[model samples]
Target: METFESLVRAEFTPKTTFLNTASNALLPARTVAALDRAARLRAEGGALDPLYADVEACRAAYARLAGVPVERVAAGASVALFTSLVAASLPPGAEVLTAEDDFTSVLNPFHARGDLKVRAVPLEQIAEAVRPGTALVAVSAAQSADGRIADLDALREAARQHGARTYVDFSQAAGWLPVDGDAFDYSVTITFKWLLGPHGAAFLVVPKDFGDLMPVQAGWVAGERPWESCYGPVADLARSARRFDSSPALFTYAGLRASLTLVEEIGIDTVRAHDLALADRFRAGLAELGHEPVPSPGSPIVSVPGLGRLQPELAEKGIAVSDRAGNLRASFHLYNTAADVDRLLDALSG
Candidate 1:
């Protein structure tokens, strides 16, 4: 068994002090190798059995990570697709309560439908704002711009009291913060960021009874017997949440299988501890330098107000981060270290 330190050393060889996992994650060497192998297999007309197997493996892995039964997990290409499906399922005048500054994908689907009455509230007020008329409470588990952790327990309790369903996006939370998919009526996550997977994969978790979704974008892959139903309407839609699945992204899933393997082996609890320590170190450094970061306690992501202008300068210094809505955002992950955090702080201070 590889120790955590040994596993980190084996998987990563960074070219820079990478502190931007919130925007895009650095791929592990093993995942890159898997991508190369997938490309070669496709170019050589090799058997695609391995690629298909990777898809199922990823579905099962995500199910385990989200603490849901495999039957409730539906594979998709993006969070938007899943959100839109949920939007389409709602009644014409249903009300959706959301965080005003939540990720656009989470908010747009409800608004675009034109018929739903969408209401936006401040993140802190989400739970208090839920009412009996609200049909769904949609928000990210972590704010994308500033990394403020949502009070999911409070929101869930309020939603239940109001008889409103919950749709939580775990895209920014899953790899480091432990998630419970069964806690919400629905949840969506993209695999590229914290999960350290390729770009073409996302996941949606529906309730065990499949909830109220209509499978508006269902393809042959949503059929109970996909290959057999290819040229016609599906003989029968999947009895499970697989009915919501888009066709699997085979090559992307092939690489994700390797990435997710690393995550499971390392354990989310271990990753969270390592990431938060580095993030807090950076926060302490920012305070010493007379800068105040957005308060995001217990989160690996830190956003410093009035520091967005330093992004380009730090990038030139080989320290990666993001400038989001005028805040300098840095996200720490299992691969980062005290040295990496110090390097970024040093660059900023200088």
Candidate 2:
């Protein structure tokens, strides 16, 4: 097995102290090289068959990462697009329960329907908020604002007892946290952030029965045999979750395939341990400097209140972080080191 230090050294040469994986992750050199190869193939009129194969390869890899069978995953481009499919499936006036300040993609679709009874509670109260009429419980596995992880086990048990379906968005958790797609009725995750892929790759996992979703956005790629069903209408839509697929961005898949390979090779457990250690170091440093970040134990992302203005100065000092809703957000990942964490602290202290 390759050591984590060597892996980081091999894949990245950061020009700055980058601690912003929550907004966008730095792509590995292998993934970038794959993108260049894909671009060249398109420019030189090479056969397109290999690019199509990349889509399936990426789907299978993401399925394994999410701990689901390949048949359960649908390739898509965005969380909102997939969430809208779930939103379209609900009948008018159905109740949906969610966390306060949950990622909007997990909340907005249900709200946009205007007829659904969408209820929001504190993130800590989500599991307890489930009621008899709640038809769905939608929340992010890890929050985008402060990286507070939801109590998924409690939420799942609560939804089960209340006869509500569960939908989890793993956009902030997949690469660094263990994902069990089978535990929820539906799950969606975009690969760009912690998954270290490009902007145009995402995955959706659905129950084996396909639940109540109607593939309202189905296109040529949603057909069981896409190549043959290109005319007036598809002869047969896919029996599996592939029915929800949008026409893939082939270049995106080509690069994502490589990044997923790297993730699997290093393993999620290893990534989590490395990331949380850096996060803990930063948290300790914050304490020494008389700063208190939002409590997000066991999570790699830290959001400190009343420090958003320091983001610009930090950036000018060759450090990168995010200023979200007046919070200075620093997200650590496998690529980060303790030295990097200390560098940010040193800058903040000065």
lDDT of 2 by residue, 1-350 (tens): 77878987899888999999999999999999999999999999999899999999999999999899999999998999999999999999999998998988889989999999999999999999999999999999999999999999999999999999999999999999999998999999999998899999889999999999899999999999999778978879998889999999999999999999999989999999999999999999999999999999999999999999899999999999999999999999988999999999999999
lDDT of each: 0.94, 0.94
Off by over 4 Å in 1: none
Residue 182's lDDT within candidate 1 is: 88
> How far out, in Å, is residue 295 in model 1?
0.7
Q: Which stretches of model 2 miss by more than 4 angstroms?
A: none
Give per-model CA RMSD: 0.7, 0.7
lDDT of 1: 0.94
- Count clashing residue pairs per candidate: 0, 0
